[model samples]
Target: MWLEVLLASVLGFVIYWFISRDKEETLPLEDGWWGPGVKSTAKEDESIRPFTVETSDEEINDLHQRIDKFRMTPSLEDSRFHYGFNSNYLKKVVSYWRSKFDWRKQVETLNKYPHFKTKIEGLDIHFIHVKPPQPPAGRSPKPLLMVHGWPGSFYEFYKIIPLLTDPKGHGLSDEHVFEVICPSIPGYGFSEASYKKGFNSVAAARIFYKLMLRLGFQKFYIQGGDWGSLICTNMAQLVPSHVKGLHLNMAFNSRNLSFLTPLLGQRFMGFLGYTEKDVELLYPFKEKIFYNIMRESGYMHIQATKPDTVGCALNDSPVGLAAYILEKFSTWTNSEFRNLEDGGLERKFSLDDLLTNIMIYWTTASIVSSQRFYKENFSHGLGTLKHERLKVFVPTGLAAFPCEILHSPEKWVRSKYCKLISYSYMARGGHFAAFEEPTLLAQDIRKFVALAERQ
Candidate 1:
């Protein structure tokens, strides 16, 4: 009887010990999975600190001289007849870039905006900040942050800045006001690339959140396209409270599987608002996109897989750099123009403008760093990454350009973005809508802002 009582007592003590330990293990701080510990503290700050942009007149002059020297060399016979510009035509185009293009004039144009450089996460980030010349009696200007994507600089918005900040240029009210801020994504233009690997879109978004806070913008709007769109979307997800609204030209919903409705329903047909007549217009071009991706995207695959290896090659050869960047301008904007002289580059941008953009990449020696951006973001499986779906409670607008590579149908976009208040099917323009059709782009922005103000 005594032995039985002792065994029962021992078992009872074991059970009680485990129950007490379990309760201790699950304290509130450890139990709260979705709580403050997961959030980054970079978003909460307010200050406008000044940073310097270090560039000398001598360095600018040297870049001009080098560009001029490159122009003087006759173009080598175009050995590859892959896309536009036969060898004979390419020779002339190279000649124009060498002799006729004015780098100094373009540099002066860039200097017109107030450019600044500041350090974030040990890397220098370059930006252009433009405030409205005049504001209404007591009203503060709305803050707008603009982000540019690959193969372009902040220069993309040069023509639209005046119109947005001072609508007198458009015969609209002089009181129309905005304080615009445009940043160069790391490694793209003047912004220094991160020394460490794994600096993907999420990291960039985090840095930008800090940037917005540092600028004293507690609440602001964001506008972006291309990789810029992805970064802005990530920003909205990371800190939706601070990003009051989002305006995008290129939209991607990495979260919602429902966006695949059209692809699954019609077996990838009838996308991009294709009609019977439009199908005829699009069939051959669609085939070409597939073909081009197969041939040219070998580089993308390499960059996406092993960027450092390919970046070494791009860093060395200027001709290789030109071929790498220029081909996208040919196929992406419009495939029909792919086989023409200058790759139909003149259709959307002036020869001078095109060369200026190319020179920016060349002078900075950033082709490899820029390409590495793709590798860093996508080399790892895109499917496995934990992407955030933004429940944006603020106003949002989208300007869908016709010739954009990927189409964001309204239904698909609405799934990920909750506060889509306005959308426009742009009449005509390609991927580089802001640079290619600034007036139309600016007008759309104005219209959207006007409507948002009323609400």
Candidate 2:
């Protein structure tokens, strides 16, 4: 009995010593900005080697010739059947593109905004930084970062930037102003795609946090929709102190079906003007959007699983590229416009504007690279990580658009985003709220930030 007691006491002492000596894993941030991780010098590279927009006269002429050639070509059976292009009508549209659309003028318009490129995490990231033309006598312009999602570029915020920065032009704001920074994710636009695999949203958030710091913003506000929402949410989680506030047009949660179904069902029914059914049925638009995405997202599956193989094809074929990309603009923006040849795309945006976005993808040759983002994020089952409702302590704002595919009620959003401070049901707009409704979008942002600044 004495021997056994002595042994037990010795074991207890050993275990306690081990436990007390073990070091807890510490995350790097000291206060808001100082993390233990080494700060990158990409910003210095950008300052020293500013990216010059390279437009060769020959390249411009070649593009014009291609437009002319495409204009003369008769509508194909596949194009007419799938794209719903009325043969004669499409000819007229093509004629306009050939004769009226001004690529040089549009290129100049893009150059009007100050564009910059910087290396971050082994990738060159492209962004547009727009500051208000005039600030109030004593106040510095508030910094706002707007992130765009798939099939869209920084062009998405072109209309909104002017409205937010110079409200007199848009007639929406009289006094409020913002200095907005819109960045193209590493894999999109002029930003170089990740060479390595496993790059995901968390990586993007970390790099963007560095970007804000490099710009000398100690604290800033972030706004996003679609994939932008994912990036912004991760930013809040990874560097909540730097992110003074967050605003989103979409919210994603991966909660258990048993808990989520009932809540989703109730809210969806209210959205659809229905009472009871399979909760999934209530969100008809969302279901349709999902189905369409799944059907059209064959490129996503391929890129996610084998990006290199398909990437070669996308990098080669312009027609293949247009079909793959333009299809999303058709379905995501307005499903009713899906069958139309022009996709009723002109109703919301001009052909030049639409082509400008396409040009960004085309010139950068980033279609396959951008698609890899979906694969890196969702293909490995990372998107399905168990949902612990995000505990956000900072102030949050939500702008809910009427035509958005998934509409989250205040209660549902609040369940996950613990510090939701403002909620607005926008009178009009869709998934690309910043692009589709700039005035309304900017007004909501101004209002939300003004409220947050007070807090």
Candidate 3:
């Protein structure tokens, strides 16, 4: 009788284990040292200092001199942006930068918001922290950390700041007022570049999490695209408890359920929870999925393997630098922009805004370090990291900008984000969703947070 009781108990336990298999896994929040030379034995200094963006007449003059000497290569006759940035168009842009663009005015614009720096893990981190101009009587504004990706900087969020912090003035409700923080990824802009090797997005996520803790916020929200998307995802995986919500414009989708639904996803989509819109957006798999990835991923291949080799020439020549960075802004904003002679650059952005982003990299001499990030993350291979294999349990939201380089169906996203609260197929935007569609992006963030609050 005793042996029979034990056998029955074991059988029941096995049945329960299968039903509750998904253990709600969590990633280890390991520590890291990103500074140069020997790891300091001393306790790292933790001080938050005020910072301002400044430029000198000498700096402007040097830029002008470089622009004056910029050598131009001839584009193929009748070739649009296909052969890269048409030199004919570049000559026009260079002329504008040298003759009309005012660096001093742009510098003042960058400083209009308060900038701050704090040391974490031996590196001086730079971030712009702006509070709502007016807060409710006794309520604290929601804290949102916005991180920028490669060939981009904290400048990307400048246009979207006011809309988020002071929505009522912009003809929107202020129900979800927020204090926005945009940080330059280390090695991308004002943030200190890493000296020791092996700094990747996971490390960045850990550092930014530390930044939030140091700022005295136990719970906050994170939003990002490009590298920002990956870093934010890692943070959600590492500390789902601390992140109140996770919002993204782009998803890496490297370790998703694509393997389970790549080819037959269209037919099986309903079973996979894909909507009718997902079918339209992700179908014609040859052109839309396979071909699009092949066409758009050349930059990743080179950056992942030989970033320094290509970046050296780009760093030396101002014109070369503009072409490499601006090309991405053009085709990435809308891939069809590649067919336009001028790359349709002015369609959604001003020359001043585009060049200002490029200037951040140029003035800081950070392109090489920025590109090295690709190699650092890819050196070990994609999806090999522990964080990549993990799921983000935090309240998640996705603003699926229609023209994004790659489309992620709700089903695919749901696989990694178990707690996905909201997903929208954004209208009239592309990969640079935040910069291109500030009003829309702000609204989606508000919607996502409202849902999170309700939950």
Candidate 4:
């Protein structure tokens, strides 16, 4: 009888083990050659070359000439930014760009930090590396890889870099001074564009992973918003062992509890791990969250479907390019900005900063290649990719800025990041948190890093 009981216990244990087996999922870490035509037989150069951002009289002259010749299309009476960028406002921005906006000074500001480019996957990867001038005694500074998203460049992080790198000098706590590395997404800014098709976020992630390894970093923290968010998430998935923590101002969702929770969650959010702030920001579901996504996502739809078509016009016309890109700066910064003349653009950002960001695409002449990134990633449709279903196992942090294009709750974020250590409902900011509210972003990054280090 005792022998039979022991055999029965063993059989039940085996049954439970079979039913509850966990999937040891991982992103496939692969390499590719992204150079122009054919893969070269010789090994690609691996040296890190110092790169300076230079603009000449000819470059500025050509830009001014284009702006001067841009044709004006008056906005419909009382029509604000409702129909893409208001033509009336474009004229104001054009006049400024043609007369006062100084590309030379902005270029000098961009070059203040050390810029370097190293070949990765046969493409030149451009990045800015800044180290803290003076770190607190007895502790080494942490390494952080900050990535910029679409319609943005390494310039987006310029304001926030100083705060993170030299917090003490900037009148902040020196608790977590970071050695920041901001890299331009391939095909954006000065980075070389991938020639062959099939260059998606995962491929970019693999290339960045190799970049980190080459930079002498065995492990580091990764943070991003926009495309930067997806790239950083992919890095965590591809090499969880190498990632100490992952922080994002944006959450990439494959479909989670967000749809279901929005309605019933208006009251029961706390029961679902969402704080009151999350509820306030997320509720009234149909207008704030639902319509907001639909309204703002038109650009995404075109970019994903027919990037080359629109990119052609944008590349040729500087005023058109500024209008197209700056419109995002207005709307994404505060959806209400769309209702105001000038799109309330100068309220939060200077023309210098806004125009400088537009200049990255214009000067590089990479608007077409930059837009193709959307096509390459979604050209095959989502879900078909492996990382879509996988969860990131590394320590995670999130800053859900109030005016983001769409809201993401803690419960929704935790579904993908199983080990989320920090989730902050940022006081005030929008899509470009670093650019709009550098101090808030810097404080949050420091907070998240401190939490991550405890483990």
Clashes of 3: 0
Q: Candidate 3: where is the Cα deviation over 4 Å?
A: 1-22, 259-262, 265-272
Q: List the global CA lDDT of all models.
A: 0.67, 0.69, 0.85, 0.88
- Residues 1-455, candidate 4, lDDT per residue (tens digit)? 56544544564455346423425477988889898888889988999999999999999999988987888998998889877799987877888888899999998999999999999988999999999898779988889999999898899999999999999898888888899999899999999999898899999889888888899999999999999999999999999999999999999976353445555535556644677787778777887888888889998899999999999999999998998899999999999888887788888899889999999999999999999999988877876777877878899999999999888888778767888999998999899999999989989999999999999
Cα lDDT tens digits for candidate 2, 1-455: 56544554564455345334423221233222122245554443534135545666786666666655553235665453254334444555456655786767888888888888776555677888989887756878888899999889988998888888887666665566789999888888887777776667767777788788878898999999988988888788767778889999887654412223332334434432333332442255445446645545665677678876777766664444554566566556665566666666667877788777877887788887788888878875742532223445568899977666555666556645767888888887777788788878888888888888888
Please provide, for model 3 over 1-455, each residue's C-alpha lDDT reduced to its tens digit, 9 standing for 90 to 100: 55544544464455345323445777789888888887788988888899988888888888888778877778889999877788889988998988898888898888999999988887889999999888856878999999888778899899899998988878888788999988888888889989888989988999999999999989999999999999999889889899999999887766653533546446656744678887787777787778877877888999999999988987877778988999988888887898898999999999999998988898888999999999999998876887777777899999998778888887668767888999999877888887888889988999999999987
lDDT order, best first, reads 4, 3, 2, 1
Better of 1 and 4 by lDDT: 4
Tens digit of lDDT per residue, candidate 1, span 226-320?
88888887777767777767888988766544432332223234532334433333345436335544654666687788777877866655545
User: 3 or 4, which is superior by lDDT?
Assistant: 4
- Among residues 3 or more apart in sequence or in different chains, the pairs in candidate 4 whose N, CA or C atoms overlap within 3 Å are none
TM of each candidate vs. truth? 0.78, 0.79, 0.93, 0.93
